[model samples]
Target: MAEADAFIFAALQQSGMLEASFQGSSWSVSALTSDAFIAIVFQFLTQLQTSDDNVTFTLPSTLTNTPVGVAARHRVGSKLANILKELGYAGDCGYNHFLYPSEKETRNILSCFLSPQAAEAEDDKFAIIQPQSFLANTLPDVPLSLESVSPGIAGGDVTSGDIIMESVGSSGVATKNVAGEENFMQTQLSEETEEQALEQVQKQVDDTEHRIAAMRKVLDRERGELQQVEQHVLETQTTGQEMQKQLARQKQLITMLPQAQANIAKLESIFQKNAEKKAEIAQQMESARDPLLKEYAQLESQKSNRKARCRQLIREMKTFRSDMLELTGVIHSKMESVRALERIHERQLAKLDKKKDCQDEGPMTRNMYTARIMDIIKQVHKQKQDITKILDDIKGLQKQMNVASEKLKRTEAVAEDKLYTAASKSKTSNSGKSEAYVECYRKFAQVRELFEELIVLVGDVGKKENIARDLQNWISQLEARDSSSHLDKVLADLESVRHENGTLQNELRACSA
Candidate 1:
């Protein structure tokens, strides 16, 4: 029974709610209290984030017969100080304040404290006071009853003490009073320590100032080098832009070169046709000459015969002259075609010149200028889309118009054949029949007029298509030239600038070092 009772008591002790004490109380002076204090301090230090805050201390009579014990108070102050330190305050007094209130209070009880001099230098300056609540002194303990106490402002029934707040103050060194040789020695030692610290700080400040001056000199040198590099880049950019302009001009010429060759071919074709017409005219002239010469021989044989032959030859000669005149007109038309082609070539050259002038205005690599060019490219692209849509719409309309015109042409052709057959038949019939034929012819005229109108409209549409095609071709050629030459030049210029920038960076680093 004795062994069983001992085991039961050990089990109760292990359960931890009950404890073995030296006397009447059940509470044991185990490591748990110290552990609890450490845990509290750890939690407060880890979790606290405040400049000013209140800490509540509960005097738990159940946890101890000695509620206001020195160890307990010390633990409480240490926890509070740890919490304040974690909150970035400068309270230096540790757990000493709780054990000796007067000494701790005079020495500054805060682990995190701030002074007025420090406050003025800060941007968000404000003061705060943390109040400590002693709950056991404010509340009554019931007779022979053990109640667990926890501290807070809310529970007035258990609170036993008034919350005390302290004033804000600064912490610094206190002057020592010298009387004996020991005191004098202590004072001299303290002064020597402070002087040494001040001298070390001064030395650090001087070294820092020297380093700053050296860095400044280096930066100035780098700045000068950068300026020189910038000038070089500017020159490179200018040269690149000039090259780009030439390239653009060449590109424009490239686009028009084929068209120029086509124009020459067209002129040659016209000239060939004219030559064939001239050759045929010459052959006819030669043939006419032979006939006239034969007539001349006949005139010699007989005078009357010669007169008749001569008159016939003269009439044929006149007809030949008329044919020559027609040939001359055809030759003139061919010459005009050649002139038109030459004019077109001249206009293309002029456009190339204009492009060159525009491209040569300045260095294309300027950041602002390149940005503007990009903006222009965007605008051009947008315009191209709009133009393409317009062209598509025009093409759609032209297709419909062509269909309508072809239908009108077929209808007009059928009407004309019917009118021609009816006219011939009406010519052999009576007056009434002739009048009917006239009415039919009038309707045919109206149909012909409608067909003519449709043709005119279709012709107008064709002209518009021609104009649009020409404009689109020009824009495409210009944009292609701009992109290949201008954009490439800009990119080259950018690369040069980037190289210069790298050089400048190296110089800056060297200067810094």
Candidate 2:
């Protein structure tokens, strides 16, 4: 739009009906004959006011500085004023003329010349310059001050029929080349700054990419290591659990060993007591008389009954053999079952590790992995339950074995007690003490034989019982007593004859008395 205005003003300047020039490089003017000029200037000013015409003319901010835009402004404004006047009103065009392009001058002229109130101020009649545009007829009492221009310039007091043209001149030479070079330099600096900024941005991008790659590698390494660690942990856990179970079983056996040793010790002590009692009874039998011998025969019969009880212990030992075999087999099965559970636990732990590895890889839906872990957890729980059940079974079998063993032990103990009781009595009794001691020793020998049978019957594979061998010397004593008892029987028969002779003598004595 500014360009179009430039063209129009250029055309008007070229039209030779008016002369145009700039004054002091700030104000501009044009002039023509007054007859047609004043009416045309009035019409143009009114049109400019009504149209609200505006032009932005670039100039150096300081009035003394010359710019191309200022030259163009002067030329265009001068041409516009000249064109206005040639089309006719009441004035020529110049800076101080009534028809000049001063906005204040034009407005005041319209107020004074076209107002009816101005006719009332007969003194203001001289300010009437022309019949003009429609807005000129609606003039108010307001006045335009021309003080900022040269005094008395373009005022309501003016009546202009003659054309006037005046100008203030400038002689400084204009230069466009220097300004063009400065603009080019600024553009180059802007382009260089832009290139530097782009390079910096690219460098930042490269650094960011390298950091991202490093982070990704670190994450991948950690993830792989974590997976391996998880697997190792699971394997270790499985091995640890198996070891713990084996240790527990070993501990249980260790606990039983001492008790077994205690039982062996107790049985040995009883055997020794029996042997000592048998020896004492032998001494007692040596000094006894014929009446005591008859009493000793009765004691001998009781010792025979004790010998039969020892034989019964042997029979009971035979019956326990099958039960012991079953117990050993059950123990083996339980161990196997425990081992199988351990294997399953290991497998489940392995699967859980795989699931965890998969989960760590990326934004995977852990649902399947989690579900698998849960399944493995449940399996582990079930394995724990199975292990517990197996342990319970082991406990039950152990209890059964202990009960059977205790029964055999108690039976053996009873037989031992009987032998010892008979032997102790033989030591205290004078009558038939030798016969009774021999018989009691025989019973102890039988009982020891039965215990030996029990050891063989219930023997664990690859195991031996140094059978309670303290009773061995006692057996020798019993054999010796058998021979002694035979001698004692003959002695008693001899003594009985002697006693018969004595009894007859006693009867004669009693009669004599």
TM-score of 2: 0.24
- lDDT, candidate 1, 165-206, per-residue tens: 111111111222224666889999999999999999999999
Model 1: residues with Cα > 4 Å off, grouped in runs: 1-374, 428-431, 442-513
* Per-residue lDDT of candidate 2, residues 302-406 (tens digit): 768767867687578557756787777777666656656665666667676666655554432335445756877887688779878888888988898889888
Q: Estimate each model's TM-score.
A: 0.21, 0.24
- Estimate every model's Cα lDDT from 0 to 1: 0.55, 0.58
Q: For candidate 2, what is the lDDT?
A: 0.58
Clashes of each: 16, 16
